[model samples]
Target: MLPLLVLVTLASIAALYVRGDLNPILCDGPCGPQYVTPPEGLATQSPDPDEAAAVGSGPIDGRELAAAVAGPLRSEALGGRTSLVAVDARDGKVLVDEGDGAQIPASTTKLLTAVAVLDAWGPDARFTTSVVRDGGRLVLVGGGDPYLTDAKSKGSSVERADLATLAAATAKKAGRGPVTLGYDVSLFEGPEVSPAWEDGYVGSVVAPVSPLWIDRGRVGAGRSTDPAADAARRFAELLRARGVEVTGEPTETRASGATIATVRSAPLSRIVEQFLADSDNEVAEVLLRQAALKAGQPGSFAGGAKVVSQVLSEAGVDTAGLVINDGSGLSRKNRISARTLAEAMAEVSSTPRLGSILSGLPVGGFSGTLENRYVRSGQARGLVRAKTGTLTGVHALSGLVTLSGGRPVAFALMSDDTKDVNPFVTQAALDRVVAAMADCACGA
Candidate 1:
């Protein structure tokens, strides 16, 4: 009687499966009750707590932003002739504008150089430093890699084009003993030094421009007089270290034939970051010449300046009244308006190709050129990132900063023409102005 009862229950379960009236249970180890999926078009549930916290509030109020910056702009330390312009990066609306006319840009001119170079070559593009074998000679060709280093790596920084590595590889290909070493720097044309630059600038504020150099031609704090020759000499030393005997002096000439080994520069993006963050004058100059070459113009100061103006003008930024003497902005003759600088910042913020420029800016009270700035209490601190420029009475600060309401704004403040004022004072004034903008709650 018991066996018949069990059989009857099993037969009923089999009948339900055969009739397609049974719910399926899915399990890896043991079977569990089946789950009923919710019907389509069900009301959506809220996001988890972590995701909700990641969202930003909204745009800042322009009115409040203007109010925040007003007092700082009135500082007497900012010089008699001051030009300033701040715009909402989202819509290009002017938040603050004061004074007029062009002012000396100082190193902030590197911003213009950065844009022109990026326009000519995308961020991922890299400059090549190649060693080519022509006849009995080993030739090192410079592709204008300014940050090329001899060290394998500097701490955790990106690996640069290393001369020792290149030499070691080249020696393996070329038989040991009796090799003539030469370098080709003809990729760049015209004078190495910009004639428009101040006489004292060379070997002080900047080294003479050359495509082939190690450590920006610096022994330590001082610069070399002839960087190309010095670089070739260093290459010879590196070759000797690799058990290769070099015969004859290293001369400058173009290399033709098979490439032995090549090391590429840390991508253009990293170069831009280092140059802008450190305000590296020589790097800026080298990049300018490279930009000219890429644009199909002569790789000279004059040609670079011309192409930079053309590139910016074509991009719809007003280049009128803007004079670019040199890429590093060491020239006092280099003139730019606050409006133009602000527009350039806005362009970088909006254009995908130019976006990397913003990341290279020095963070306030944190890193690079701005490490010592914005240190005072109630200041912007890490809230601002900009390029600082200073020359005598001329001081300029320009870059992007987000307001309290999470809106990013681009600002440029140029103070010039004042006599006998301390540079630190002017810099402090400029920082205060930027801090005001960062501290704003504006149109929340």
Candidate 2:
């Protein structure tokens, strides 16, 4: 062995090298190490085609894909007629098409409503709910803001226009004494409940469509009988709590005087996202009417339907043979083809104004309406994002899905005649079909 001191010095040098603090080859003072730089040509080497192919692999056989998904779609569990259409979101190539013609769309109709509203009012548009002075009475004017709330306004994204905020603003101008309180729902005209809708839809799936309502006219998940009246009562209560005494019960009237306090809603884009993600019927209906108002038509179910069709047609979507009875698709008479839904989704992907609609769709096995769905199949768990529609006999799923090659595909599947079959079974069948699309490497 060498001297102990030499050995210790050698050990220290080795330790320094190990710790990356010493360079053996450079002994000069403050030595700068030289690194071998890769050549420009090597740095920019073209990716191997084979490796690219492997990374972007997808289904190569369309026949095999059809065979894989056909059985579940044809299963008796899905009652009545079944219509489906899938297209490459990038190229609009038809991946799957079955049973043409219109079918009951259910809540998937909101997708159309969303596009129409976004077309009529750009994403940045905002709705305003205001309090104006009508003589000595304070009249709350509805601006067709669906997301308005009773809770204190948090910010732009959370709470739009809260009663507390509106009341506080109104209190400052109206002085302390008792004032007559009323609300103007004239912003929306026609029947509160759609004649085409089933009676059970009220107080269950949706409330009466109104220009102004708190929490989407919901006491919770359940709906209030007369949402506008309920909202007016709540507004009065808030005004009373704010030291502004209300003389009597609040009633509906038109505001034809100076404006006092105004509160704007969250931007239209955010409302569309929440409506689509949560499948909010009230929001959908309100947006439908709002779209009609924007289009210079009466804010009614018929007016909204006409405006929606007109707007979609203007957007280059084929509205031929399309019948929209209501904005929310609560009406069983509502008919839409899978091709139309897929086309609309494709339009959403291509159109800059409507692009945000895709992000609002529920991701399979992850968020929103589809959280509990796609649980049985891992294939579509994170890859598929869709809107689910369910009624008694109607089961529909439509949205976008990323394939094996990371290509996005838009699909719409509807089964409207399965009243006899179990709903869970129908949903499972639909899930399997969408999951198959995600797993497919067709034409890879």
Off by over 4 Å in 1: 1-64, 156-159
**CA RMSD of each candidate after superposition:** 15.0, 12.7
Across residues 373-430, which tens digit of lDDT does each residue of candidate 1 receive?
8755457766677888888778898898766545678888898865577877777788
RMSD of 1: 15.0
Error of 1 at 125 (Å): 0.9
The Cα local distance difference test for each model comes to 0.80, 0.80
Cα deviation of 163, candidate 1, in Å: 0.8
lDDT of 2 by residue, 1-444 (tens): 569989999999877654445432443111222332322222211234664487454533456556667877777777668987887787666777785688899999999999889999999889999998876799988998898898764323536678788888988898756689888999889998998999788999899999988888998769998888888898888888888878889988888889999998877887888789889899999999989999999999988999988877876666667998788888999999898888789888888898668868887776798888765444577677788888998999888876655667778899998888888998988888888876665664
